[model samples]
Target chain A: MEFLSYLISGISLGSVYAIIALGYTMVYGIAKMLNFAHGDVIMIGGYISFCAMSYLNFPGWLALILAMVVCTALGVVIEGLAYRPLREATSLAVLITAIGVSYFLQNSALLIWGATPKVFSPIVEGTQNIGGLSVSNISLLTMAACIVIMVVLTLFTSKTKMGKAMRACSEDKGAAQLMGINVNRTISTTFAIGSALAAVAGVLMCSAYPTLMPTTGSMPGIKAFTAAVFGGIGSIPGAFLGGILLGIIEALAKAYLSTQLSNSIVFAVLIIVLLVRPAGLLGKYVPEKV
Target chain B: MLKVNDINVYYGSIHAIKGVSFEVHQGEVVTLIGANGAGKSTILQTVSGLLRSKTGSVEFLGENLGNVAPHKIVAKGLAHVPEGRRVFLQMTVEENLEMGAFTRPGSEVDSGIADVYKRFPRLEERRRQIAGTLSGGEQQMLAMGRALMSKPQLLMLDEPSMGLAPLLVEQIFEIIKELHKAGTTILLVEQNAQMALSVADRGYVLETGKIVTTGTGAELLNDDAVKKAYLGA
Candidate 1:
């Protein structure tokens, strides 16, 4: 019974990581740059929703929408201002700039929201007992939301014209441009969608933990990055599978082994998997042809 | 329909194109034939807005294409089928063609795709197959079919025969001739001078970034200098 409960919660947490991982994988796939500020963007999303609900007196649903919209705009702005100029720069330079943006976002959140953690109310307030397993409504909702988002994203990428453009840009930016797809707009749209996903993850995470802090997204951000790398950084389904597997592993480790060793276990697994299959579970190895 | 006037282009410190100028009329197949590193592709890139010229201008259909974005250049009825047949490796042939018509209205996309499929039935057969797995000939067909999907007035092909079997090269050139007969103006950049000149209405021989000779396709094909320099005679 305890194992089942732990698995449930682990899946919920994994969904959060999956959502955030989608952002990292997508931006990296299309723009070929890591937006290290992605995790901080989650913090900003939480803060926006928190501010909307508590200070602005907005409804919960409205607050969520507001957070998504603002985060989408912020993502586009950040890409245009901080990353677009560095499109042709070396990977090292872009990586450093991303780290700088991450720190800048964290500090800005700290200055505005302060160091004290704020309590957040769960979006849904109840528990559901299914087949003798008592599951928090938030967990079920999180999993449901993640599944829905994944399905919709898959449809969007596979069916829509803009989605095809995004895939084309990822494959070859120069060729995409030659086809008359606006490369800049496609990149901005990618950032917008990624940041919007981060917002949802942030809100769900805060609802589950019932706490909001400037550093709240830091750990989850790193974990999600790990998830992305584990699942093939550019593959969407890979991100989903990697997040759930990592979450379940961490949960099982914490339950069976010492709590202090859970983090070490998770990283050890990552290292072993990388050594065995460097491309991650679902990543394809693409060789450069001369 | 296109005119390049004394355009000078540089790749950082290396001047790739030096005051080169040419024109492509509304219904003629114009060929730019040169040896490797002779700036044929550079001229195409500059006209397509992928690279900027240090001096001079490119006028397409009488509109000066200065500082215009690449996508906008395509919207204005200029499609560049880049070198290496740069088809999206992960995407299917149909999806690649769909991307070609990206600037067009949604209502026109289906017909555009159908048109490409009609032109290259091989693409229709492998519509759902990933582009990377296709043979070199099929990839080249897909690349050209993709460019045609945009319904451009002028199509610029950069080395369409690069790394293809001799038979496939002949077939590709036949398709190029067919496209020209169907009224799509062509700016062909090629190292296969014999085939390119055979199909082109006019020819420009570029040497070390300069247009050293210009004449009718037959005139250049028969010229002693061009024969000695490019034909391996």
Candidate 2:
């Protein structure tokens, strides 16, 4: 019974990681650069929701939506201001700039939200009995939300025109531009979508843990990034699979192994997987054309 | 329909194109032919707004294309089929064609794709297959068919016969002739002087980024200098 409960919670936590990983994966896919600041965007999302709910006395759904909206705008602005200018620059330069942006966001959040942490009320409370196994409502809700998002995202990328444009840009930016697709706009839209997902992750993660702080998103952001790399950095389904597996591993390790070593164990497993399959589980290995 | 005046382009310290000037009138099939590193592709790229000329201007359809984005250049009825057949390899053949109509109306995309499919029946046959899986000749055909989906008034083909079998090269030239007959103005850049000159209405011979000779296709094809230098006589 305890194992079942831990597994469900693990899935819930995995769902949060999956959401964050989606942000990382999508941005990297289209822009071909890691937005190291993605973790901070989640912190902003959590802060936005916390303010909306407690300070503004808004409903939970409204807070989520507001957070998503704010995060989307923030993502676009960050891409335009920080990443766009570096478009023609080297990968090392861009990577360094991303780290700078990450620090900027972290510090700004520190100035605005201060160092104190806030407790959160679960967005969906209570328990649900499933086949004689008890699952918390938040766990069920998180898992359900992840499934819905995965389905919608898959369809959006496969069926919609904008989605197709995104895929084209990822494949070849110069060719996509030649095809009359606006490469800049496609990249901007990707950042918008990614940050919106981060916002949802922020809210759900805070709900499960019931604590909100400026640094709340940093740790999970790193975990989800690992998950993204674990499953194949640019593959959507890979992010989800990696996140779920990561969550399960963490949960199981904490339950069975020493709690002090669970985080280390998670990272050690990632190193092993990468050594075995360097491109992650589903990453495509393309040879350089001479 | 297009004019490039006194253009100078540099790649870092290397002066790739030096004060080159050219123009293409409506309904004319113009060809730029040269040996490797003669700046034929550079001229096409500059005209398509991919590269900026430090000096001089490009006028297309009466509007000066001053720093217009490449996609906007396509929107203005100029489609460039770049060298090396840079097709979206992961996309299906049909999707690549659909992408070509990205600047057009959504309602007209189907018609545009239908027209391309009609022109290249091989593309229609492998419409559902990934572009990377296609043979070199098939990918080249797919690239040209995709550009046609844009329904541009002027089509710029950069080395259409590049890396293809001799038979495929003949077939591609035949299609170019057919497209010319269908009233699409063309700017062809090629190292295959014989094939390019055969289809060109007018030809410009570029040597080290300068126009060394200019004449009718037949005139250049028969010129002793052109024959000696490029025709490998």
Candidate 3:
């Protein structure tokens, strides 16, 4: 029963990582540049949701929707203002820009929201006794919501028009351009969708845990990024699997070993995975064109 | 018909295409033959809107293509089969073909794929295979097939015979002939001068990004200067 609780808790944590991983995967696949600011966007979403709920006095569901919209718009703006001009520049230039954007967002959040952690209203506040296991409704709901969104996202990418465009852009941007796909629009749309998913994750995360601060995104973002690389940065299914697997391992380690050792375990797994399968479990090797 | 009026293209400070100019009439196959770095690919890229000319005008069907986006150039009825056979590695052969017709309406897409299959029966046989796993010759066929799926009025092929075996080269050239006979206008760029000229209606010689000579296919094929520089006589 204790193990079951740990498993459930791990799954809930994994859901957050998967949501955040999408942002990292999509941008890296298209632009081949890691958007370090992605996690901050997740933080931004939570803050936006918090503001709507507290200051605007909006309903919980309305705040969720608004947070997604606002976060998506911010994602588009970030791409336009920071990424578009540097499209032709070196990868190093873009990497620095991404880091700069991240720092700027984090510090700005500190100025506006303060250094102290803020309280967020819980999405669910009760616990359920299932087969002698004490499980919070918040955890159950978070896991369920993650599963539902993952399915929708999979379908959206595999079966929809825009999804096809996004995949094409990732495959060969130059060829995709010849096919009459507006590469810029496709890339922008990718950012919007990835960030929107992160926003939903942020709200759910805040509701489940209820404590937030400016630096909150840094840890989650790094973990999610590790998940992205572990699963293959360009493979969606890989990201999901990697996230869940990482979360489960982390939970088990934390429960069995010292808390200090728990942090090292994640990186240890990453190093092992990298050694075993450098392309990642689901990643396909793309040879550089001659 | 297409008209390239004294276009100038640059890569940073390096002048790639210096005052290059040419025209391709409807229902004609035109070949541009040049050595490596002769701006052969650059001219095609400029015309297809992949790269903007530093200074020049590219008018296709009376519409100015200068400064237009790459995809918009495809909508304008120009399909470029790039130098390398850049088939989508992760996508299946059929999916790669589907992406080729992304801009076309759904109703037209099916027929487009069918037409491509009809032209390249090998693609139909390997429809479910991932494009990247194909051999170089097969990938070249798939690249051409994918481009044809777009149903372009004008098809521009860049070095279609680049890495093919001699036999495969002959086969690709035959396909080019078939496309021309089927009334698809073509602008072919190639270092394989003999095969390109044999298939083209007219030929242009590009030397250091400038069109040094232009004539009917046979005229250039038989010209003393062309024979000396390109034909290895």
Candidate 4:
């Protein structure tokens, strides 16, 4: 029973990581740029929802929508302002710029929201007894949200025109352009979707933990990024798989081994997995075709 | 029909194309034969809106293409098969075709893909297979088929025969001939001067970013200087 409880909470934690990982994977897949500022966007989302629900007396759903809107716009603006100009630059240069953007977001959040932490109210309160096991409603909701998001994202990319356009842009930007698909618009749409997902992740994460701060997104952000790489950086389904596995491993390690060594164990496992599959579990190792 | 008027293109500080002017008449096959770095690809890129000319204009269907975005140029009836067979390697053959018709209306895409499949049955056979696994000749065919999915009136092929075997090259040239018979106006850029000339109705010799000479395909094919420099005579 205790093990089951740990697994449930692990899955809940993994769900949040999956949500955050989707943003990283999508942007990396389409724009071929790592938006390290993505984690900071989660922080912004938390702050947005916090201000909305607490100060403005907005409902949970309304706060969620507001955060999504702001984050979506923020994503588009960031892509346009920071990453767009560096499209032709080297990957290392873009990665450095991404780090710069990350720092900018973190510092800006500090200036705006201050360094102090806010006690976050659980968006969904109380617990539910399902099949003789009691679980927090927020945890169940997080898991549900993750599954629904995964299905919706899969359908969106496979069935819709814009989704297919995004896939094409990821596959070959120049060829996609020649096919008369608007590559820039597709990338911008990717950013919007990714950041929107980030907002959902932010809300869920803060709700589960009930502590919100400007730096709250950083650690989870890094873990989710690791999950994305574990599953395959460019594959959506990969992110989900990676996140769940990472969360489970971290949970199990903390429970069975030593709590203080959990993060170290996680990183160590990652190194082993990567050594076996360099492209991650789902990523295709494409030859240098160019 | 397309008209390129005094187009001067630059690659940053380097003047890659200098005062290049040419035209592709309706249903005509025009070949631009040149050595490497002679700006053959640059001219095609300029016409397709990939690279903006430093000076001069490119008019397709009697309208200037200067302000048009690269992605929008195909909708204007000019499709460029860029240098290297840049098929979406990760995508399946059908998916690549689907992306090709991205600019077209949803209603027309099915028929467009059907028409392409009819033209290239090999693509139909490998519809579900990833493009990267395709043979070099097949990838070139897929690239051409992808370009054709845009319903282009003017097809600009850049190095379609590049890196293919001699037999595969002949097969590609045969397809080019077939496309010409089907009334697609072609602007073919090639390093394979001999094959380019044989299929071309007219040919232009590009040297160091300028058109050094121009003539009928047969005339250039038989010219003493062309024979000595390009034909290995």
DockQ of each: 0.68, 0.59, 0.65, 0.68
Q: Is the docking of candidate 4 incorrect, acceptable, medium or high quality?
A: medium
lDDT of 3 by residue, A81-191 (tens): 999999889999999999999999999999999999999997557899988988888788777876776677778777777787788888889988988999899889889
lDDT (CA) per prediction: 0.91, 0.91, 0.88, 0.91
- Candidate 4 local accuracy as lDDT? 0.91
Kindly provide the TM-score of model 4 when superposed on the true structure, using C-alpha atoms: 0.97
**What RMSD value applies to candidate 1?**
1.3
**Model 3 segments beyond 4 Å from truth?**
A286-290
Per-residue lDDT tens digits for candidate 1, residues A119-143, read 9876677899999999888888889
Model 2 Cα lDDT, one tens digit per residue, B139-185: 89888988988889999999989988899999999999999999999
lDDT at B92 for candidate 3? 81
lDDT of 3 by residue, B1-233 (tens): 99999999999899999999899999999999989999999999999988888777999999998868889888878899998978887778888888888878889878988898998899999999888778888889988988887889999999999988999999999999999999999999999999999999999999998899999999999999999999999
Off by over 4 Å in 1: A286-290
